[model samples]
Target: MKRMIAALIVAGALVSLPACGNDDTNTETATRTSNTAESTTVQISSVTSTADLGMIDQAKLAAFVVAFRTAYADLSQDRDDESIQEIVFSSCNAIADGATEQEVTKEIRDLAANDGTEATQSQAEQIYKLVTPACP
Candidate 1:
């Protein structure tokens, strides 16, 4: 009877050990998941603010158009359609409330040069609203 009781106790201890280990692993996993979720939430909030500011402020938008035109003229030697479009879109989108024509032009030119393209007339015209209403 004494030996039987000892064996039963040993069996219980073995089972309980695994349970304790499993609990620790579960706790660690939960902690990691919670931290990951929090980080993702922070990133999402930052992206939202950035996107909100990405929208056009009309005056600055006009300046961006002017910049794109200037840059296009400067880089007309090696123009690519896709690159021009990209520069026009990116520069116009950068226009904020108080941006100047020179500032916008410089941005557009820099973007165009970096992307290896000249701004197209159509793309320039599209962005031109940020600077002039009569850009054809």
Candidate 2:
């Protein structure tokens, strides 16, 4: 199923993120002088941090939201934008943390189910399908 494939892909990507390394670096130099006749030069260097790359792609996230809302208008209409985003991010985080597809599906399902109406695996699958594309 699409859900299973998406979940597996997301899970794999997440599990591998920690093992990846960023070797890109940047260096800058600044010079300053004061009336006291003292001059100072400072050199700063930084490497791209994993945290910088850990975020989900914004465009993809937006697309996912649109797709989700279209697919599940009734469910999405009840939640605000922030709430939906939070759910997607939470699901992505779980995948990154090495949770299996079933685990991720169950988590989102439980969260959805708590909001007055019972949630189904199919709904969870749709959520997972929509969220996986947004993961960084």
Candidate 3:
């Protein structure tokens, strides 16, 4: 899950880079991307044989992943860690950007629906609870 989350953050960072424009938002985006890359490297080295991830504290992210796996075993068993991480981290980012719990839950539920799985509001709330403290 951490791997997935990291991957998503990295991808988002890359995509957020400025395009042929010199502006504060562009500079800010570039700085954010750089920081994200640095964090990802540090995070990857800290993990033992786990997938490289970016943003958030890895240990806490792992705990969230473990709990998520147990809570949604049937839906998550076949899903790769990276993808789950992506979903979780995306939600984490949203939370950081001021999205409400209900909004996050709806987003998570929607993501599950894409996999043909029906995720409960409680499950979504679990994600909010676990990722909130870990989000940087």
Q: What are the lDDT figures for the candidates, one per model?
A: 0.46, 0.58, 0.63
Q: lDDT tens string, model 3, 32-101?
A: 7678767765755564233323556655665556656655676586776756666666676677678888
Off by over 4 Å in 3: 1-53
Model 1's TM-score against the true structure: 0.29
Candidate 3, lDDT over the whole model = 0.63
Which candidate number would show the highest lDDT if scored against the true structure?
A: 3
What is residue 52's positional error in candidate 3, in angstroms?
A: 14
RMSD of each: 24.4, 14.0, 13.8
User: Candidate 2 lDDT, tens digit per residue, 1-136?
Assistant: 4544564556556434444444331111111112111211110001122222235554465456555556566667677665666666677778878999999999888765535665688888877877787776
For model 2, the superposed segments whose C-alpha errors exceed 4 Å read 1-54
Cα lDDT of model 1 by residue, 1-136, tens digit: 3433354455445434433547778688667656765664454345444333233332233334334444345653455443444454444345544456656666654555534554554444434443332121
Residue 28, model 2: lDDT of 14
